[model samples]
Target: MYCPPAFREEELPALHDLMRAVRLANVVTSGTSGLHASPLPLFLDETDGPYGALYGHLARANEQWKDTPTGEALAIFMGSDAYVTPSWYASKKEHGKVVPTWNYTVVQARGPIEFFEDEGRLRGVVERLTSLHEAGRPEIWSVSDAPEKFIKGQLRGIVGLRLAITSLEGKRKMSQNRSAADRAGVAAGLSASARPGERLAAAEIPQG
Candidate 1:
């Protein structure tokens, strides 16, 4: 999370929104095994802490949950990202100095990681996560949709996660470092591209 001043986003509300919008997060922890990372769909309990608590689950057998973290764990959430080509920068034609880069929104949550097997907590986390992702669907699913015995069995195979987030860092790189002309060129170029991510990035760029 090397956030330059121009790209850094320190607003808490914006960071929370970004984290929530990007459902899946990468949780990284260092342990005796060196480092382990798990891609999990995490839900943020904004009211739980100043920086918000994180909730998720991992396979019961995942050694990541078993090993004690050496220090703070990091949960990474990534939003729309796209490759920015030199051809999209006006500076490229002026001095031929512009190189390719990427535009993206990212949030990193650093905290102490806790893993537990309490069925009640696990059930609550799973149900909330399901509802968050299944909202507005044709047929929303719920934890109770499955048989109670079956649900219990399923829960048995997973472990619950809770992280009292101590720090939240966000960065939004959307051609903010480029000159006005170069930013406009990038927006136009990306807006005309077929890639959905590129188009999203285009709309994020500042337009004069």
Candidate 2:
């Protein structure tokens, strides 16, 4: 994440918010075979360590769990993102110097990756993940909803992951680099976009 000072977001609460809001993250690791990345729904336990710990599962057959990483693993989470057109900039009328860019919020977490197959730990992780995602549903579901034998059989097909976060990097580019008028134009353009993501991003940009 090449974040300029204006776009850097180092506050812990903000970083955690971004990670938690974006439950699905891309976990990347480098092994002897090269680099491998997997898109996984991860749960962040802020109280687990200084930075925090990430929990999730990988399919039992996933080679990513089998390969020992050469270094730390990286988990990337992305928030609302939108394309900004040069035509949305006020300066474009005076001088066509503006170019298209993307506005987005993202976080990168780096840590040592650990994979486990312990039934108890795997069960705990699965239960927690399910509850987290189903917290507000009208008909809540739980691991206990299934028969013990069936649940155990299902768990056998997966491997658990724990990444003790050592560091975190976060960035939010929301037209802050643009002039006030340009930013307002950007906000208007995004708010009128048909894409839901663009409308979400409009709220992040400043208004004149």
TM-score against native, each model:
0.95, 0.96
Best by lDDT: 2
Best by TM-score: 2
Residue 124's lDDT within candidate 1 is 95
lDDT of 2 by residue, 92-127 (tens): 999999889999999999999899999999999999
lDDT of 2 at 195: 96
The sequence of per-residue lDDT tens digits that candidate 1 reaches over residues 120-173 is 989999999999999999998998889999999999999999988999999999
Error of 2 at 65 (Å): 0.5
Q: Backbone clashes per model, in order?
A: 0, 0
RMSD of each: 1.4, 1.2
The count of residue-pair clashes in candidate 1 stands at: 0
